[model samples]
Target: MFTDEEFEKYLKELDNPDLSEFEFFTESTGVKVYRRYNKTSGLYDYKTIGGIDVPVDTCFAVYTDLEYRKKWDSYVKELYQFEEDGKKGVYWRVAFPFPLSNRDYVFVRETREFDLNGKHIYVCLGRSAEFKSKKEKSGVVRVNDFLQSMIFTSDGNGTKAFMHYYDNPRGMIPTWLINWAAKSGIPGFLAKMVIACNSYDKYLASKK
Candidate 1:
């Protein structure tokens, strides 16, 4: 569980990451991805910055609405929440491309809102969690190492999004393949998110 101060620290880090050790990876449209090596974990940490031409609240809604996620998140083969405790839960999933084994995560996610420099900001943090009731499923690789944070700030026109993600699949995958996917995958995901938010906004408007 992250305290309010820790969450605030994360937000500060997102706004100003120590780029000295990070290397530029790739960019698509307005999204840019960066990667840094973690000596302790022996894995790479990924960060992405991008702007979506949608309201901040809309973006947050699209992200947290798990039921609505299936429509836009093409990689999610299956997802369901279990053992919910407020914003925390064990979410099942089958992700990654074909030929690779599916992966599942037992994680706790929390969201908080605050004002930063007169702009409304929403922060969502997620990390792996363990429980006695949770167990790994058959034919799926359980992701034991995972941490993700998404910060959305309302700009005058739209929203600016920053994503910090770190995960290890715990398998015999090549580093090059993982790097390739991270570079290409994140921007595409952001693009899809923008489109999905727009679609959802239209859907809401039409109902009025």
Candidate 2:
């Protein structure tokens, strides 16, 4: 869950962000990424804009299906939901290349729908939170300072996606790793997501 102020601020940013404030990072396979410096975290905040050749509803379904994601996204080492002290959140562990420790996150995510100028928009937001049931593992970097907001809307026969991403992966990050994330990691994830969305229905059917 998010605070009212945070909700309002994120909505404004997603609805209308000043491009002048961000520097172009990279574009891959039709997906464009921009980044801006964050003084507080001493890290960069990224914006991903792209068009997916899938319906908005399908995109939402695929994005929210945590279990289904594990089947397609090979980068996810571990992912699941947990509830403790009457509060619930998700736990995620991501794989990293050799010489770098894996990264983990504990966060709560929410989805909302809105109508702006007669257009439907779906937003999925996530923020880092602590859970008594979850603890950091040894040799794994915990990403406690993280925020993600993704917007999805119909674009003709396809869907348009806008995502704002920020996270402190903890420890030292090499310049090459950052560049790889921008040029390949982000865009590659999106590309795989489209394939997942297209096959989500079949994935669900197999479960039944």
Candidate 3:
């Protein structure tokens, strides 16, 4: 279990990651994703940092709204709150392309909001969790090794976002595919998110 203070400390570290160790993977629009190998874990870790042309609140809402996720996140086949408390849940049947088994995650997610340097910052932390209600679904592989965190800071007329993600989907996946997904897939997802945010903002404006 990670405390809020610990999460905060980790988030700060991600902000100033040792760029010397991380190699550039890909960039889409303004988002840049990087990849590095962790010798200790024998797994690849990814970091992404970029600015989106949307308010911090809007960007944060787009990320946390479960119901709205399916509209923008193409890979999310199903998502629902399994536990009553809503903090612990399952991401069911995330779609991977042909020849790769679908994957799912059971995670505990927490969010914190604070102000730093006169800017509002929101941090979301998620880690894999074992829950009694979670069970492997047919044709979908359960992802047990997953840790993800996202930080969004209010920038002038937009939001600056940072993400650190690590996951090991145990299967017979090619190293080239894994590298491609980390490089191309993530930035594409973020680009779609920016479009979603803009559309949502227009929807909100129309209601006014």
Candidate 4:
């Protein structure tokens, strides 16, 4: 779904060392969050870095397994994969607190493995996509603008992970919700991911 030049651009941004444009948002659950303004969207983009004491493969699996994600992620109201015209896509519906409408997204995702400088890295890239066969549900806002990239690499006995995320959840959003996303939402999700990674082997065995 992405061109080679576009992928290279993403890699360049991931490799960028200039943190002067970003401000530290929070640090919790072994993850540090940073944010920078996106002039194009008039919103903020997030950068997250952390280490999990799990194998790199396990961590990557936990992040990519949609079935397993439904078990660990409470915010995931619905998630599944589909194929149309020989292309694969993902649909996700996120649950919001009371009185607020839920949000959904359709994405085209790709995963790549690279050996750079003798270090093995796994990257997951995703962007919003339009699928003619997918229909939107009533009362749920469709998030058409979303981008995410995750990088996982071995760090000694553990895995070092980084994420870059941006999305425009089109609709009316309150200040409190925005604050919660930055402070509690992201870290809480990562914390649950760690737990999921720990049990991923058992989960896989159950499937066999």
C-alpha local distance difference test of each model: 0.81, 0.84, 0.79, 0.84
- Kindly report which residue stretches of model 4 are placed more than 4 angstroms away from their true locations once superposed: 9-20
Per-residue CA lDDT of candidate 3, range 23-111, in tens? 88778888887888877555688888889899889999988887678767888998876674454565655888898889998887888
Cα shift from native, residue 25, model 3 (Å): 2.5
Q: What is the lDDT of residue 151 in candidate 2?
A: 83
lDDT of 1: 0.81
Score every model by TM-score. Answer: 0.89, 0.90, 0.88, 0.91
What TM-score, to 2 decimals, does candidate 2 have? 0.90
What local lDDT score does residue 30 receive in model 4, on the 0 to 100 scale?
79
Steric clashes per prediction: 0, 0, 0, 0
* Tens digit per residue, CA lDDT, model 1, 91-121: 7576767678889888888889988777788
In candidate 3, which residue pairs get closer than 3 Å at backbone N, Cα or C atoms, i.e. clash? none
After superposition, candidate 1 runs with Cα above 4 Å error:
40-42, 84-87, 202-208
